[model samples]
Target: MTETGAAGASESPRPRDSATVMLLRSVAEPAGSGFEVYLLRRASSMAFAPGAHAFPGGGVDRRDVELAPGWTGPSPQVWAQRLGVDTATARALVCAAVRETFEESGVLLAGPSTRELVADTRDEAWERDRRALLDRSLSLAELLARRGLVLRSDLLCPWSRWITPRGQPRRFDTRFFAAALPAGQQARDVGGEADRAAWYAPAAALSAWKRGELPMLPPTMISLRQLAEYTAVTEVLAAHRDLTPIEPELDRVDGRERVLLPDGTTHPLR
Candidate 1:
């Protein structure tokens, strides 16, 4: 939540619409929690949250708002009701969630039909398509249409929404989503914006952040805290969430500026 070496600006930039997916899987040997979440360490050279551990996501692309790709599972109308957006925007957000997760994690959430998932995506042809998606040369719609696949929107569960605190150099109004890693799909270190990728039990990740071994933004930290309560991925997917947007505010605490979250916790604003 804190931005170092930059003075606060008087006017805040409008937040960009973005989507983030927290990919999870059940762990056989529990380490403080029964499930582990996938996280990527942003390359230090990135402008935003450099070196921080985050989920696989990015800003919604213009193509995401284009004609909808083949889709199954929950309809966009239902998603609009759940995500608090119009049907079109809801579809775009869901498309972005699936596209970003696949681009960053090598795990596709789409399949030939509603009841199936792409078992493996490590083939040479798949990698070529993935690279095209990453570089903006391919659209998710076109990709799905060509391959006779449909996006499995039901694979994703709405978690929460967060807005970057005002006055930062960049900001995003991001919808957080939770999804179980699909069976037979493996998440690998497909580096691009991230320097490394790994899975961590929710509690263990928080412990690492506390020990200064992992740095995270408030949203990621808070989401992990929530996830740590569940013993199974199914429990997380079945849980209902209140999706009111959380935007941190600036407050002066004990002579130092800090970011005040809706829960009243304060993070030092460096």
Candidate 2:
């Protein structure tokens, strides 16, 4: 049987959850199709997906399901039907997606001059406060409440969802979302979970990886390949307007190191 990364010696299982987010943007390039995607290089100290470029996201929090206000995107009922969960859960997941994105990326998705968001984005004061909050295990809900802010769920558009392949020590049932880059807001690596960050044309990023410089999980790789087909963010956003969400199950080949896609195709990992 083909082996995997540290699987033979490890007997314990890894934890997983259905949560994640991808941040995509459009670039002002000379070419017509100019959508560029943002990717973060996780710090080497991370237990999993180390040194891999990924979007800013993580698992849902208990508070995310609480459903606060200033959100005006998809109706909870619409998300409930699509997410295959109760309206409350759907709302929480959406909240989690936005909140996680903020925590991991320092990109705030919120509404009103609730004291905190306004202060955080005004020149990194809020960012400093947020960093402290993250270190203290403070809930995003607490932060919002303390600062009089509302989660702006309207900014996030549901894109795609992916589940990690079975047999992976760490698995994730990730949901991808796209947001237009906010005006006057630029992204930085924030130097904790992510050591570095960059923006690249989707097609260019794929080509670079083909040349073997970048690392990508199956879902991220496929998403970039698909995003490469479009030239602008408008096209990509338009494609998902129907809000058709895809949930793919990853199947691992028995006694060998290979994974199968729904198309009955297989790929091997290094």
- TM-score between candidate 2 and the true structure: 0.81
**List of clashing residue pairs for candidate 1:** none
Among the numbered candidates, top TM-score falls to 1
Best candidate (score: lDDT): 1
Native-referenced Cα lDDT, model 1:
0.90
Worst 10 residues of 1 by lDDT: 1-10
lDDT of 1 by residue, 1-270 (tens): 443222564578999989999999988854667789999999999999999899999999999998689999999999999999999899999999999999999999999998899999988898999999999999999999999999999999999999988877789999999999999999988899999999999999999998988888878988999998999999999999999999887666445667788787787542
Please, what is the TM-score per model? 0.94, 0.81
What local distance difference test score does each model get?
0.90, 0.66
